[model samples]
Target: MIDKVAWLHLHQGQVLSTRSRGKDRYYLPGGKREPGETDAQTLVREIEEELTVALDPASLAYAGTFEAPAHGHPAGVRVRMTCYWAPRYTGTVQPAAEIAEVAWLTYRHRPQVSAVDQSIFDWLHDQHLLAE
Candidate 1:
């Protein structure tokens, strides 16, 4: 399994998502953990790199983890996504680094995300956390 961390920034019932350069699928904005890095460390760094925002590490909250067949990968490969919610952040969010675009996606846009992200959308929808 490919382990990764993701940030969930929900506002007005929409989640912040990003599309990497040359990627067709949008995803929750975060990335894999570097050596010796905690989830919070990885989350803060990833979000900063991908979304041009500074996530408050002290306020990071564990959301949930979703696993599914990896998008744009071999069939047998899978991704285990550990998600978190950052209640506070600084700076305006914009596409940065390898990110090609940024969007506020709702449950209706589920199909545009990766499989693991779709599962995250489903959970959010089931909890009524994601909607138009």
Candidate 2:
């Protein structure tokens, strides 16, 4: 299992997503966890590395966990995502290493996201947290 952490960053009520350099679909901003690192630690490090901003460890709120077959991986390969919502953050958002594009997508564009990201969109919509 690939344990990962992702952030649901709402900007002007819009959710931020990113497409990796070689990936075709957009995904929530995050990355795999390193050894000896907690979820929050992995989240902070990933967000900083990919978005060029430091995340407040205390501000991370556990959203939910999502499991899905790895998009481009062999059969039986799976990824476990620990999602988080951060209503408070410091610094500007910008694409960094390995990030191809950073976009703020709404509910209407949910189909364009990864399967796991679609689950997140549904959960956000159910919670009345999606922008549209």
Candidate 3:
């Protein structure tokens, strides 16, 4: 199993997503936590690295957690994604590091993301936080 953290940045009913270099699917802008890092710490670092933005730790709140079959992995390999929402941040958002593209995605884009991300889309849509 793999563990990962993600940031849920919503704007105008769309969620920010990123596509890594050489990858086909788009994903939320955060990554896995390093050893000894809390979820907020990991979120801030990963978001800065990937999106060139600093997520204010004080503005972080739990969104939800999801589990699904790991994309492009062997059967039974799973990934657990814990997500957070940040209401404030600094800097412009641009693709950085391994990110090749940044997109604002809605429920219609569900099939273009990974399994776990699809679940997030569902939740956001149900809550009317994501556009149809």
Candidate 4:
């Protein structure tokens, strides 16, 4: 299983998502944790790297976890995504580094994201946190 951390930035009923340089599917803005790094640390770092915004470590809240088949990978490969809600951050958000596009995606855009992110969209929809 590939363990990863992601930021759940919901605003106006849409979530922040990113598409890598050559990828078609969008994903929540975060990445794998480094050695000995906490979830918040990983999230802060990943978000900063991908979104060019620094997440306030102290403002992160546990969102939820989801596991699903890793998209574009060999069959049977799975990914466990630990998600967080970052209420505060510094700087502006933009597509940075390997990111090619940044978008605000709604639940209706589920089909355009990875499996793990689809699960997040489903959950958010069920909770009415995501707009139709």
Cα lDDT tens digits, model 2, 1-132, are 767799988766578999999898899999998899999999999999999998888888998999887677788888888998776778889999999899998899897888788888888888787878
Model 2, which residues run further than 4 Å from truth? none
Q: Estimate, for each residue in 1-132, the C-alpha lDDT of model 1 and write its tens digit.
A: 899999988999999999999999999999999999999999999998888889998899899999999999988999999999999999999998999999999998998999999999999999899995
Model 2's alpha-carbon lDDT is: 0.87
lDDT of 4: 0.93
* Candidate 4 lDDT tens digits, 4-86: 99999989999889999999999999999999999988999999899899888889999999999999999999999999998
Error of 2 at 5 (Å): 0.4
Distance from true location, Cα of 12 in model 3, Å:
0.7
Least accurate 10 contiguous residues by lDDT in model 2: 7-16
lDDT of 3 by residue, 2-77 (tens): 8899999999999999999999898888888899999988899999999999988999999899999989889999
Global lDDT scores for all candidate models: 0.93, 0.87, 0.93, 0.93
Look at candidate 2 and give me any clashing residue pairs. none
- For residue 41, what is the lDDT in candidate 2? 90
Looking at candidate 1, what is the lDDT of residue 95?
92
Per-prediction CA RMSD (Å): 0.8, 1.3, 0.6, 0.6
TM-score of 3: 0.98
TM-score, each model?
Answer: 0.97, 0.93, 0.98, 0.98
